[model samples]
Target chain A: MDPDRQSELNALRPDLLRFARLQLRDAGAAEDAVQETLLAALTGSHRFESRSSYKTWLISILRNKIVDTIRSQSRELSASSLADDDAGDDLLDDALFDRRGHWQASARPGRWGDPEASFEQQQFWNVFEACLDRLPAKTARVFMMREFLGLETEEICKETGISSSNCWVVLHRARLGLRTCLETNWFAGAGT
Target chain B: MLSCQRATELMSQEQDRPLSLAERFGLRLHVLICAGCNNYRRQMAVLRAACRRFGSLGGQ
Candidate 1:
């Protein structure tokens, strides 16, 4: 590889690893994804298009690889059963609030106080990660890309090949799911 | 008047930006009549604030 291209790959390696870890949810799979991405980049140098930034182009490639991996694994492990269990759990928890279907009120201003308080609480992150892990694959991916990685909606739409409405829907569902999970599991005893 | 589900949906969007004129009007009318929706709005505001603060910590 040329020196410039080699340096570029090095610069992107950490981000690529981080992206892969979130997408795959396994350190081993992340390592493999990074290796595959770098190998592809090195061999496909001639095909590099100048229309987009190198980082974006490489990320586009990595996203495809991640999706391909997910799809293949999904075929091997029936997602329907997993989805059914998750849906059932959500439904059961929904029943716990009240007959009127109201749960703890939505988050309000001056209630939770400083946002950093939640961030500084390590327990919150643990619960947050657990809640994230429970999301369905596509929803989790969209949520992580948008929320955790701080990717723009447009970039998420492009990377996922989803329409704007679909992206919003996915994010909506993910947020609702996480909110319900946190309330039920983490804040159950806290005064509402 | 917006139903609770409709209000909830609108509230979700409001987390990202100020409600649209229609949404604002609907939300206002709903909250005026429905204490539940008012609480829902407050809940969403708190959630957004918490998320903005806590989300970065996990990313790091």
Candidate 2:
């Protein structure tokens, strides 16, 4: 990489680190993924001028590294976390719904006009980031594998070592959690 | 008839795969009649849209 390009990549490290840390939730693992991503960017022959495209490109690479880092955790560690993931779900049911399977009165989804428009407002992303932070780490990982990386169910199952049904459950739970959080903090505001 | 809970599960599952005939019919029937579930479906769509944009934009 040229000196100018190198500096540009350097400037993006903070954003990249923050993104990785949010997704991975383990400081050491996040650092490793970020480091490997930067190294890959440095060694690759791809040339770039636009910072936007380069950051996009770097994030794509970082996404893969994050998956790999999570996938590569020691067997015992992965098993323990997987158990944690399973145990977390039972706690969500009563809080979200009643015996009749209806949403609790206060927990129903709220009206949010034009969600896409929030993308144009920079502050919306901060609220979004906060909402994401409120999720359990493993649930967020499953959600990230499916949504952020755009992986299919089968691929996510393979990467996360979860069954298809379990994957669906985690995603459903994550959506409910994130949806409620965003509504409370951003969307349901008097004038968002 | 699917409950609001069940309908929302199918809605989320729709993100990954085509719902089964029974699931599709049931969820649609429930969502049409239930305002809470309809809102949930739309919110799920919004989350999907937001995540896609978020993944690309978070690098900045």
True contacts kept of 2: 0.75
Most lDDT-accurate candidate: 2
Superposition error at A104 for model 2 (Å) = 2.9
Q: What docking tier does model 1 reach?
A: incorrect
In Å, residue A53's CA in model 2 sits off its true spot by: 2.5
Docking class of 2: medium
List ranges where model 2 is wrong by over 4 Å. A74-91, B58-60
TM-score of chain A of each: 0.54, 0.85
Instruction: Show model 1 residue runs off by greater than 4 Å.
Output: A1-20, A32-116, A190-192, B16-19, B32-35, B45-55, B58-60
Candidate 2, A55: how far from true, in Å?
A: 2.2
For candidate 2, the TM-score is 0.89
The most accurate candidate by DockQ is: 2
Q: In candidate 1, which residue pairs get closer than 3 Å at backbone N, Cα or C atoms, i.e. clash?
A: A106-B43, A107-B42, A107-B43, A107-B46, A108-B42
lDDT of each: 0.62, 0.81
Encode model 2's per-residue lDDT on B1-60: one tens digit a residue.
777888878999998889889888888899888888898889888898888888885513
RMSD over all Cα atoms, model 1? 7.4
